[model samples]
Target chain A: MDMQSVITAAIEAVAAEQGKTLRPLTDDLVLLESGLDSLCFAILVTRLEDEVGFDPFTLSDDVYFPVTLGDFIRFYDDAARSQAAPTLAA
Target chain B: MQHAAKPLRRWLLEAERGRGRALLAPGTRLTLDALADTTGLGALRGALADRNVLVSTGSQLAAAEALVELDGLARRIVLAPPDLKPTDIPAVMAGAGIDAVLCDGDHPGFGPDVLIAVPGPRVPLPDAAAAEVRDTEWVLLTSGTTGLPKMVAHSRAGLIGAIDPSALAPVWGTFYDIRRYGGLQILLRALIGGGSMVLSQAGEPMADHMARLAAAGVTHLSGTPSHWRRALMTPETASIDPRVVRLSGEIADQAVLDSLRRAFPGVAVGHAYASTEAGVGFEVTDGREGFPAALLDADGAVAMKVEDGSLRIRSTRTASRYVGGTARALADRDGFVDTDDLVERRGDRMHFVGRRSGVINVGGLKVHPEEVEAVINRHAGVRMSLVKAKSNPITGAIVVADVVIERTFPDTDAARAQAGLKAEILDLCRATLPAHKVPVLLRFADALAVTPAGKLARHNA
Candidate 1:
């Protein structure tokens, strides 16, 4: 499955487990405003890592906190690509 | 001779005829007489006399042997736990003024003036070596609010003030390592209380220990709540039956108490409030979570009262003083040891909420992990749980929980069943606890980590 679909499914799965209804998962959807709660994001990342083979938070040295659904998905996608093919440091 | 002046070897009691009690270790067993053996202890006593000694043995079994022999010989005996970090050993040695090191074997770790004695079953003690000597101060290490271990000193009379040894001649077993206060209580009980003790192996498996306890016919067993939870998980728990079960060192939540009662039908399952510093406060055997409110008002040897949610006990049972380091006074001017365990009054009973220092700051509110864990553990699916804080930019920190499922569900609907259990746990938390105390992140674990002290490890995720 594509990274976006996988990430979306994981978020839905975690929300379903928590009995929470998410505001529509869209590119510009702000996570803080959504029904998802703080620290529940850990469950999302854990589920995502099991399905997809990477946890973006630990793989990259750069500190980044994604604010939107798109940013979250993009971060995981970039982490996966970088993990699969290491690029030379600029 | 006074009991205080007598060594633990003198405390050893032998049952009439063939009923002699023994220290039953996994690979070996030593009867009461063997424990009283002065074969090598005669010269060893002279060498260790009037010295500040550190017992850093490799095993709990060795510790028992060392403690029995060294109790009266040394001016002060400091117990070094088997898992003492290498980095912290020197500080411990310096703090307690540990001049001599006693070990089971040769040691490069202790210091230059190392004394060695291989403790095990030996020849019967000679009658001449049984004479009592000067009183020795028993020093125990407590990891107080300050992370570093502090040396707490106690007298023989103080340690035994609360233990009313049984007349039934019961066999004792414990999940606690004997170096710690909880485990040391059991060893003392077996020695002076006319019972045999089954000591847990240093790195033995839980299943193996339970099997050993069963083989030794353990009539009474004691451990922290964490140990009992893990024991309940092990299959051998069913075979290892005891007449009486006890819990100390950690909060005994309703879930574990009810579970123990269910596990051992008609057995006397009790929980006591005891610590390295507070000694033994009281025992509640009515199968309740906490002690009765009347206990506080009642006149007893141990005077207890809750001040600002923390339980304070003033009694002869409490450790006398902080032996070394710039440690704060063990007791206040009123001679009360601040237990630092927070308890909440619910009707007539005061349930232990959590440690006063272990509170997790959830936003501006405080959440005790033990309280959250109690709520989560009440769920039938959850065998055990650890509630910890997860750092969040939004709320400073948020509560997170890792739950260990009691049993495996069928593969056909396992995922669904687990999800349903998680939802139920969250619902239970919501119904019982405040919103801020509710765990935001929940994940199932195969097993939760327990520390060497046999309490739940609560490192933030």
Candidate 2:
């Protein structure tokens, strides 16, 4: 799956677990505005870690402060691309 | 007859002179003189006087010493424990009127303020002069887990007055241990009692630190229910050999209290109920179910009336005013400050029903989150739980539970395991709690949202 799809799946899994209906979580949608409270946000980070290899808890400082969903996705996409580039070079 | 100077400053000074040892960590020790030279408190006093100084160092020892030094110089110091995001900084600054910000970590580009990038045990520069001010000597921010955090400002005398010498004597001997406010108070008491103080780093590994505390032969240990929960879960916590273990910050439910008593059979288990705005009021150490209520007068309310039901304390330890706000005048009209906590009086003792704010009006009945959270936390699968009101069209407001489950069942299917856990938790709650008190919805996670100080953020949940 593409990075956006992966992110969407992660968000959906958290929403499902929280008994929240999934809305179109755009890159611009603020995590707080996405009907995800603090607990759900923490769950979402955990789910994302399961899907991706790295733990997303470290991104909390960034996510809580200035970063938005779009910012998070871009960061994730960049990291994914960098990881892939090494294999491609090999 | 000339009385001697306060023992707190004297002990610090003696520790500085290398007559006594400074307990940095468990095995790591420093002379008081060395600590004094390293923290640069003398220069800090000269540079940043009455100005609202923010001590943002990551080290607990440095931060604790800075707080003491600032208190000594009569500087209104706001101790911002590490892990505070830059986003939350502005609101704290505005509320407390912080004049300068200091950080031990690499500067995160926090605007134009003089960002002193000094490490611990380094000499403080005298460039920043202390401000001549004295409205609020210390402003502690409430862990804003719900909404915007509130600043609790205490005057120098008021803060010191809040300490009860006898209450702390049972747990800590010549050594002082405290959790949150109690920790600060213990530090103050060490100074007053002519004792040595040990400091714990905020975010270090729990097991490692507790082992250190065990090796240091700590006499006193204090923390909130949540801190104790994490400590109990720690493998090394079994090794701690403190003479006293005290709990505060939140309500001490029976299960957790019982567990603590069982764990530390020889040690005294005590609990105190107080707040940032009200300061310390009621203390219970005899393993009581609840704290004794404040004494009431002939008028059928609290006898020490300052306002409404809020505690009207006349002790010399009361904060002069809310920092950055107007001076606090006792609302003697009722002769008591309404504590906002609903209580049931049993002769001289008072059992807490719930805080007026913490009570949830579910349909016609009222429920307390603490009661529900206690039930949820009792479940073995649940690591921690928080209960709050979510807007509901049918009930107006419904109770919701957010829980963190233990990692033992990590490999189990998330959906199936969560369903089973929820069912089990709901069943337990139904059996013990009132129908309305049971949470309508349950949210599970690997971890709960915690404040920098390791407190569950109820407001955010």
- TM for every model, in the order presented, reads 0.86, 0.66
Summarize candidate 1's per-residue lDDT along B164-271 as a digit string, tens digits.
655667999998888989999888888777689999876789999999999898999999999999999988999977999999999999999999999999999999
Docking class of 2: incorrect
- i-RMS for every candidate: 4.8, 11.8
How does residue B127 of candidate 2 score in lDDT?
Answer: 34
All models, DockQ values? 0.17, 0.02
Worst 10 residues of 1 chain B by lDDT: B10-19
Error of 1 at B111 (Å): 3.1
Per-residue lDDT for B1-461 in model 2, tens only?
10122323333443325346454555466545544444454455556655667777766665665664555454557777455667877777766766676666565655576434344454643432233223436766655445545556666555566554434322232112232455667666655443455566655678767766666566777777777877776778888777777777667766677778878897888887555555665567878656554443433311343233333543334334455434345323433344566655667665555566777776657887877887887887776788887654334466778887755455658678778888999889978886567776678765666555555666612
